[model samples]
Target chain A: MPAKKLNLRKRYGLLTRGMGWETTHQKMDDVFPYDSFEGIKITDWDKWEDPFRLTMDAYWKFQAEKEKKLYAVIDSFAQNNGQTNLADASYLSAIKLFITGVTPIEYAAHRGFAHLGRHFRGDGARIACQMQAIDELRHQQTQVHTISHYNKHFNGLHDPFHQFDRVWYLSVPKSFSEDALSSGPFEFITSISFAFEYVLTNLLFVPFMSGAAYNGDMATVTFGFSAQSDESRHMTLGLEIIKFMLEQHEDNLPIVQRWMDKHFWRAYRLLALVAAMQDYMLTNSPMSWKEAWDVYFVENGGALFEDLSRYGLKMPKYHELATAEADHISHQIWSVFCSLGNATGFHTFLPTEEKMAWLSEKYPDTFDQYYRPRFEYWHQQQKDGTFEFQKGLPQLCQVCQIPMVFTEVQTDPMQISYRVTEHGGDKYHFCSDGCKDIFEHEPEKYVQAWLPVHQIYQGNCGGPTLPEVLEWYKFTPEDIGNYIGSQDHARWQEWTGEDKEVKQA
Target chain B: MSDKKNTVFLILQDNDDARPIIESVEQDNPEATIQYQPGMVRMEAAGRLVVNRETVEENLGREWDVQELHLNLISLAGNVDEDDEKFELAWN
Candidate 1:
């Protein structure tokens, strides 16, 4: 008997654990381009299995239903001329970062998840990966469609995807994602699902949704909230997958820790964009980097660690480093925005005196002493046209691909700690050796970082100058920076004033 | 072969608040057929959802910002055909 065929119950439960896992996975030929993703491997399809136990019907039913709900809101808004009464066009400035930075990351996710759907060795993993692939596609499509309407009425809504590839600071998100996608299946799960999905998506999503509501962008708010709901499932998958891997073998502990350390710093570094948006981008309801990190990292992470401590992995290596970092990211991002605001499509007026006072009060530890001085300098230099750009090029980390952000903590008195590793006669610089240790475990792996500086020196990004490269991108002047004092701000004021009078009448 | 009874599918209130929103949907899709009842209006569309600000402005007594319409929507059922637009509702 060539492995006697058994009943469904003998192999897996009824519509549970792994139903249609093998069959649908075997249908990879239906999707095309499978052979090209990697070499042919029939065993790969057998390895695919879903943890969520979701079959095709449930998947389509849920997705179609979700799309319908989302479309209804869009329809209702259009029917009601809901776009007109927006609190401020300045609000779209926050989305400018998404259009330029975070949105493209979804495309990267699509590519990565599609890869996972192929290479993953079980039906459970394959199905989840496929669903994630579709989710990424849905995200990209809906975002473009939503933003297209604004493109008609607004200025900066054009070719953002191309801009993402060539832009300067945008390399932060790009390099971070490509690094994760380049990794093996296990590390990809650790970096993206565990670190990015569960740990950081809350930080990104909550603020985006809240800001959309405050600015009266209903469709963005609705879609963001709905998308985040699916993200919770992905987060759970990350949590379960991580614990499952760790428990499977004792040898997995150090391996798991190395990945945890590596991805924590990598993910944290890319979140500089979120840090910038929270600190500087929003015109009306702004959040500070410190406050967001406190709630998102310290509090949420504390709870998660309590849950995961049983798995032999500890809280991320740089918990102290990040907690110390809270004091610095806001001021750093605000500085970047203040310098670059003029060329940006978003607005960045000086914080109102009231807002300045609030900042001083909120950051009682360092705001007035460290951040306010720069505000005063820019206030004067902006008038004098003497503000200088930190031109030339930023030295990106070998692994994370962000410009080096590690520095001595302002609050701590006597610690100049940094992490580095040397492998095969080449030294790699990381913000934390936590990342470097992961790299050293397999030096052949991370040496191929797509650092923008390296790329420009290699003539990869259409010459180094910002304007020259911007030409190679899909961005207009409107998609670049700060939100206040922009054309949209003027229109916001114009529309709000007229609406007020009508309401009063 | 033919099952048709003068169908009353949707109901709407004609308060001035909703006229702008109701009218905007009608104008954008153009094919949307609307029925009006005492203190209500019922509109139906077999196609994609359309929410353009300019269309709503042409019909209302006065111009209104998009956020204000959240107060006017009572209930919705069925599915939204296309979701490329932003939506608002009354919720704290």
Candidate 2:
């Protein structure tokens, strides 16, 4: 008779455990110096649970299958001209935003997790991070490959990596990832794995994926399905890391709590871009931003925080503020993009009457009262041939680096909710108290931030003038401005055989 | 089952990959309430929820690793007890 096969538990243990040895040549402390500097006490590295029992062999097999399926679809999407089937060419603006702003973050995550995989003491955690590191790299590659077809038929996707580092608006996501990547291993995991992946991932991934599906972008939808499984593992790892830290030692509670508070706000603020994409960018909207937030964050995140309460962990600070801002952030972000249309890598347009009616239904209290009038006024301005983009750059928050566009949702929707602070006689501005609190905690770190607006003012960008700045950003005339008469708009109309009369009516 | 305080729940992305697991969950937990939302599904039970690997495999028509459930899992409430054969969630 053949010997009984090992079960997954025992198999995982044999594969991953007892891989590390006591070093007589080098002290374990010196080898893993980063584990202790953050003041997290780990009495036993053995207590670190392997969140998922995935071995390297199994991981390779699963990913290979997924890749096979994904590439097949992507090939077909290109062969069949999937771009023409989209709800509208205007939808590509959201995809351009995604590739420019979000895909680079996936690459950043790859680097970040690879760092964690090396620095952590526990074999379990090291293995998990190593797997996740590969997963992130895979996501980055798949995202690029999936969107490359769009790049063939569109503008604004030519120089994502170059633009990610230098563009003013891309700084929001760039700085957010850098903040996590530069932290200690524990804090990096806490900030990205726990706060962003576990607490706020659905807000980012679902909107883009579902938006893709709703708009007839089959290639993107397939990529989403492929990435979904890997995301689940990442999310599980996130939950495990937080629970592991909180349960390991009492001293870690407050430190973890503070990191959670800071990173949650950072992640939420970065998600404002996603909010605009969901609410306005998708031609056939799957759901409103408010609706997605309510379901994903309010209901799902509420359940997560409740379970976490057993470890004396509460919700991230100012979660209520996030809830309040949900009704307004999407509109605010869309308006900001519209105002800076000439400077943006993708086109921005006023929502059609049908979309405004949808927004009014989705946000009855806020939309009709505060945002619709501004859009209408802009539309009229465009019609009268006097439309103008905002020439001066907006003030950026020091901590999140988002332009100071958010308003005091609870008090007055018209008043921009700005906060101020001073360190060493240097004044810094913030979009909200959440950002102010983050900066106040680590004033030294935030002060060194290479703010885009400050850099542009100092003439570090291409030149002093707007045209030079656009040249520096690698923007062609086709890449920036309103969507109506842009090259993308023209091509899409040509492909669909819709004349000016049909499009206007 | 109606008492909110004692309930434990699991939310999964609604898709073809999760259909068999969802069916198995419904079969295993009779007291659970199932909800369908856009792109997701939620299952809530009064005090406990268990996902048996055997049942899922039966529904899937193949061997199913219990860990694969995480692929579709969005969120969950209650303490978790997971192993090779089964996954369970309940308040401690």
Candidate 3:
């Protein structure tokens, strides 16, 4: 008799799951102890589905081929000396932001998914989380390897690993990942997978990758393509997990809704960095940050929630606030970073005439009316050789850790938006009412937040002075300040045979 | 041209893996026109654009799932109608 072949779906279904569990030595609860602590009621674990239906054999084979292709590109890029091929040296500032703020989050996500893979009771969910865990680790490795080529000649790329841990601006991402990592398995998956990956990921990945391509950075583009391929599968897992949980029990609706609201605001605030990078840092930006938000969020995100409404879910709280702030958020944050460029780990520059015109065309409602005058004034001061930098430290929000830069909801944009609440005989400040609500719900968790500005006053950083703090952050004189006369700009001019100093003399 | 405003379009990242998918799109929707950008490709057609999973499978010589279209998808500008066999985008 000849052996018979099996169907792929049936074989994957059987091999990936449906292996009967043995309880001879220990009970199920004892083996999976962390499954039930979050007050989440899963009536039937069998309802969970792996939408990708990927088997171990196919995953390894496909992934190995992708890695081979990625490495080949990286090798060619290095051999051809790709560092001198950028649109301008100022473009590297966005890459600096990515390495410091985003790469470490990948490592944190890998750790969180590894824990979820072990702890979830559902076989389908466990397998999906385990695969995502491997994908995240690969993302981190490939990202570091791809970007490390620039470190050979660049200044700011040297201490990103160390800076990610100690720098003030970086606490935005560090604290975000730590928040997700510290939660239970359900909330962890809801935060990183559903909120960050499904709802907010394209805003972070797409613009940056396309900007890299447009600016001639092929190394970053290769890494972006590799990582985004895995992201589609992770997104499927995210959607599947939400549907699985909501379908498991009707009681899960309120819990899931609350998680969505909380994680949405958290993830949205973290994307302020991406918004600033897109609008201000890229020398040859593909599109405006407002346009990307309109395309990715208002269009796609609105449709996604409409689909989820079938399961008794609604749009996240403060969804309207996010829509309203799209025109102003990036502009406001770029202004703040420009004023405080002396303290940042990346270079900051006022927009060129070409870029300012693009901004005015893209943001006709806000840029010309509100932000253009301020940027033009700065450009005038820069021409006069008065190089201004904001002198004082900003009061950081206890919940989101951003400076108090957001404006009041209906009031003038000049007035800073804030909410003060008394918790344990101490007043806590938040940037918005949404953040205030989050703290009021979990006062105990948020009261212990490590606010960066507060730590500096308390002498937890290097010293009291600005230079000492900059030293503690591992920044050289070349890494910070305005981009026009910075070392990188000078070198770029020399490389392109457009050195302005000699010609001016 | 103002015709672009009336067209439904899809943009995908350009890479070796997307070749079969592009071929499928060209074969299935003959009225569609293609444009190239740095590191990406765009397909535009008047009124509608459709991507057939069977066509993609024929080009790639494998079983292709419609959901796999997202692996190369960058952006699209129309209402989507998707199922196990087909993915169609139209202004309606």
Candidate 4:
């Protein structure tokens, strides 16, 4: 008789935990130096659980099937001219943002997890991070391939990597990722896997993926489904890591809390871009950014934190401020983009009157009162031939790297919420108290920030003139400016046989 | 058990990947309320909710690993205990 096959748990144990052996040539401390420096103590590597029991054989089979399905959908989308079926050409702006701002971060996450896979002492964690590293790379590749179909027909889709490196707004996401990548392995996983993938991922993915489905972008929706399955594993790994840390040693609570406080604010600030995309970019919006925040953050995150309270972990600091800003950040960021439209990779436009009405309905408390009039004024300026992109560069926050556009919503919606600090004889600006506090904790790290606006003034970004800077950013004239008469808009009209005159009006 | 404070819930993205798991959950936890949102489904029960691997595999018509449930899981509220045979959530 054939020998009985090992059960799933034993098979996983042999494949993972059983493979790890004590190092004889090198000290374990010398081999894994980075994990201890962050002040997190793991008393026993044995306590670390394998959150998922996926073996390499099963992983390859599952991912291969997913890839096969994804590519088939992408091929069908290309064959059927999926671009022409979108809710509007305006919807592609969101995809453009995804490629430039979000896709590069996926690559960074791949690098981060690869580092973790190497540095982690526990075999379970190493294997998990290794799988996630591959997943991140897969996400980056699939996103590029999926959105490349639109690159053939759109203006702003080209040169995403080039723009991601040098562009001003893109720096927000770039800096956020770099901060995570540059941290120790534990903090990297805590910041990314826990704070981001688990706590805040739904806010990002749900909006974009659902927006794609709602707007008829079949390729993006397919990739969203494919990536989301992997995200689940990432989220579970996040929870397991945090739980393991908290359970191993009582001393780890405060250290974990501090990292959560800092990284939560970082991840939340990075999500400001997604807020803008959800609210203003999608022609047929799935839900308002505030509504998504309520569901994903307020409700779901509330439950998660409540569960975590057993480990003495509380809700992140400044969570109340984030909740308050949800009503306003999307509008604020969209306004900033509209002001600097000429300098951006994608076209920006004042919302149509219908969209403004939708915004008013969605944000009854803030939109009509605080934001609608500003958009109306911009619309008037365009109609009068007096509209121009803001000529002066906006001040960027030292920590978050977003422009100082957020307001003191808790006190006065009209007052810009600016915080200032001094470090190394240099005054630094922050978008909020959260960013300022993060800077104070590690002024050494933040002072080295590559503020793009300052870089341009210092003659670093391919000369001073706006046209020179645009050229350096790899942006064509068609790539920047208002979406109404832009090349993308015109091509969309031609493809869909819609009247340009009607669209312009 | 009917107290709101005792409630434990699990949310999964409502898609083909989760359909079998959701059905297994419905079968195991008859007392739970299953509500479908736009693209997600939430399963809530008083005090406890459990996912049995055998039931899921039966619903899936193949062998299923308990950890594969995370592929569809969106969020959950409660302390979790899991092994090869079952995954359980409760307000312990």
User: Please, what are the lDDT tens digits per residue for candidate 2 over residues A345-456?
Assistant: 9999888888898999999999999999999999899899999999899999999999999999999999999899999999999999999999999999999999998998
Q: Per-prediction count of colliding residue pairs?
A: 33, 0, 0, 0
Name the top lDDT candidate.
Answer: 4
**lDDT by residue (tens digit), candidate 4, A367-441:** 999999999999999999999889899999999999999999999999998899998788999989999999999
Taking the tens digit of each residue's C-alpha lDDT, what string does model 1 give over A73-147?
777877776768565555566676677777788888888888877766555666677788888878777777666
Clashing pairs in 2: none
For candidate 3, give the lDDT. Answer: 0.82
Kindly list the per-residue Cα lDDT of model 3 for residues B1-92, writing each as its tens digit. 12433456677789776888889889989999997866878787876889888998999999986656655666554445566678787653
Worst lDDT run of 10 residues, candidate 1 chain A, spans A496-505
Question: TM-score for every candidate vs. truth?
Answer: 0.71, 0.94, 0.91, 0.94
lDDT of 3 by residue, A1-505 (tens): 7777455457567866775354569898898999789878898787776655676766777788778888999999999988788777787888988998899999999999999988898887888888899999999999999989988767688877798888888988988888889988999999998889878887877777887898889999878867877875676577678878888889889999999999999999999889988877777778778888886788667656766787998888998898788888888888988999999988888887778888888888778988899999998998898967999899888888889899964667667897899989999999998888888999999988888788899998999999999999999888999777888778878788773421200
After superposing candidate 1, which stretches have Cα over 4 Å from the reference? A1-12, A16-53, A79-83, A341-349, A383-391, A410-446, A478-486, A493-505, B1-92
Mind giving the per-residue lDDT tens digits that candidate 4 earns over B14-88? Answer: 689789988988999999999875566778887789999999999889998776775566566555666778888
Docking class of 1: incorrect
Among these predicted structures, which one has the highest TM-score?
A: 2
Instruction: Determine the C-alpha RMSD for candidate 4 after optimal superposition of all C-alphas.
Output: 2.6
